[model samples]
Target: MNAHDPIRRCILLGERAPRESLIRLALSPDGAVFPDVRAKAPGRGAWIGVTRAELESAIAKGKLKAALARAFKTGPIAIPDDLPDMIAAALERAVLDRLGLEARTGNLLTGAEKIEAAARSGKLHLLLHAADAGTDGNRKLDQAWRVGKDEEGSDLRGLALPVPRTILAVALGRQNVVHIGLTERDAARRVSETLTRWLHFIGSHPALPTCETVSQGASALQIIPTGAGNSVADDDTCEELE
Candidate 1:
């Protein structure tokens, strides 16, 4: 949608969508196929516009294999039986890698007190809770976020990440990271969009609204409005919890 967002046609759906919204699958020189979730892989690539379930359906019906053969103009590219699992794992790693990068860049704050203070000060763009975090703690933080935004009249946002505490702590290189706050809007968008895609891929519908809904202020998590031209492809990764 934006100047930098490229449009690619999905080989399966034949529909043109922003590159970020489609999944990229690349063929290596030796004819091996791998899911290029980051879209930075080398060699020729094909795009698919379907969700994970749809992709699985395509595989089940032999459509994906046939389509890939046609796209690559090859006879048969030994499609891995666990191709879906491979893509899922790669996406998960990409999400965790991005989180780690954010932590290293000091754009992320962990720990309840630090996150709460950031939220209270209206400096937090997003608040992320681990999936396995206690309901009491989650409620307390949600209340704090609401109170802080109410006081400042700011429309910040928060969500429960699909990742559990153990994965979050490991990703952040911390001991126990139950909660996290992102102070940067770009970082928050990246994290949220990636997580959303992952959840969709795994057939898990999150309770939160889509980014557009959040940006429109139609949801409880008042996200800062990103311009209309931004597309889902702007978020570079995807995955679900184990």
Candidate 2:
């Protein structure tokens, strides 16, 4: 964890974790619960580090309601039936917004040729592919990234997002955004932070095979490539680029 990331305890799990890694649920004056993804909302808030499935289970079992009551010290906290969907939507919006911001700043590069050149020249800080991207194209770019990072024999590869090319293109205001590369370190880190949090909340699935968000550091960011059904640990400590 970064030294600056404040630690907060999850009301549902009672486990302490970095605030950035957790989602904050703000309590309204009318006793309603809503997701505060950016954590910018004012007033009393409770943090949760559990995944959507876990959260739904807690809600069904009345565990989340009891925890909220204890945390807020209030009565009749109204838990919405669609709280899980709301949280997922909020997280997805956050990720898309981050990408759009980066695109506007000219930190993102598109087109297979451009990304391949950046990767081969070691200028790419992060690489991403749309969910429906072709396997051959993905492998080609993955090879380029490895060559640039001097890890030709290793398993370092670009992340595959859950969304398709159409969604990514719309978010970045581009055409056919099948692949994307971040040229700046800070831009990559910022995108990765939001992406990681979103991914962690949704939890890994077979659709997101061999994918992960970038890690913050002086060197190139590292993402652990895994096969389908493999899982990445839910932690903020991004692995070094060595």
Considering every candidate listed, which one attains the maximal lDDT? 2
Q: Please name the candidate that would achieve the greatest TM-score relative to the true structure.
A: 2
For model 1, how does the per-residue alpha-carbon lDDT over 92-127 read when each residue is reduced to its tens digit?
A: 787788889999998999988887887777677777
Score every model by TM-score: 0.80, 0.84
- In model 2, which runs have C-alpha deviations exceeding 4 angstroms? 205-242
Residue runs of model 1 more than 4 Å from their true location after superposition: 151-157, 207-242
Alpha carbon lDDT at 6, candidate 2: 59
Q: What lDDT is reached at residue 222 by model 2?
A: 20
RMSD of each candidate?
6.9, 8.4
Predicted structure 1, TM vs. truth: 0.80
Query: Candidate 2 on 32-66: residue-level lDDT in tens?
Result: 99999898777667878888888999999999998
Please, what is the whole-model Cα lDDT of each candidate in the order they appear? Answer: 0.68, 0.77
